[model samples]
Target: MVFSKQVESPITTEFFIDEPTRAKIEYQNGKALMARGPQALHEHVVFHMEKALGRALPQMEVRFKDVSISADITVKDEMNLML
Candidate 1:
């Protein structure tokens, strides 16, 4: 599900400054669109991906879901080289 709205202000700075904690908002062509949360299938896939990565690379850290503000999955080592 995607929810979109038009705002009077520029979406760059102001959108993030007042963005809701749970909101995944995107800006496109002056429109503010809220992204839908992951579905069950997507979550399951991510979970398995995380597990597989962890097993494959025992020395690295495998993170899934909200690893960063814009990242869904991340693999990081002690040096943080592959981020």
Candidate 2:
């Protein structure tokens, strides 16, 4: 899973990963957490990424959070671009 946010100033990127297919995100805490499932790893990764964004840029635009799979996830394939 992947997530992103557009911020002002010099643009940049960040990364994160949750352990044991689980993670806690400070932003949108409930929205992503609720997505838990068999593909928990994917969800956790996205959650981790979202939290990393805050660490990378405290003033970042967090509303842009996105999620997708590294492999071809037929279900969310269309959302890859959003990631």
Candidate 3:
């Protein structure tokens, strides 16, 4: 999901199940979710594109159901913008 072409929509806290240490997140249609798996490669690409054009997405909150860890994150290509 590439969101480096427009402004980001306001995102709020998200709820997920299980630990997300190695889990990968995919965003689409203004929705964010954590998949079960490692995302080192995906992160490598995204992190590298931090300075690229159209890469400024909105920030969202992440919470674990297992009480492991939580933090604020930005989701790319994960929001529907109006006007």
TM-score: model 1 vs. ground truth: 0.21
Please give, for residues 1-83, the per-residue lDDT of candidate 3 as tens digits.
22322333455332222223434555563234324334544453444465474454346667578566689997657365555
lDDT of 3: 0.44
Per-residue lDDT for 77 in model 1?
78
TM-score of 3: 0.22
Worst 10 contiguous positions by lDDT, candidate 2: 13-22
Q: What is the TM-score of each candidate against the true structure?
A: 0.21, 0.22, 0.22
Each model's C-alpha lDDT?
0.39, 0.48, 0.44
Model 1, residue 16: C-alpha shift (Å): 25
Please list all clashing residue pairs in model 2, or write none if there are none: none
lDDT of 1 by residue, 1-83 (tens): 33222223332311112223334534473233323444533333433464577632122335588565565787777896754
TM-score of 2: 0.22
Task: Give me the displacement of residue 81 in model 1, in angstroms.
Answer: 62
Q: What value does the lDDT take at residue 55 in candidate 1?
A: 38
Q: RMSD of each candidate?
A: 20.0, 16.0, 20.5
Q: Which regions of candidate 1 fall more than 4 Å away from where they truly are?
A: 1-38, 55-83
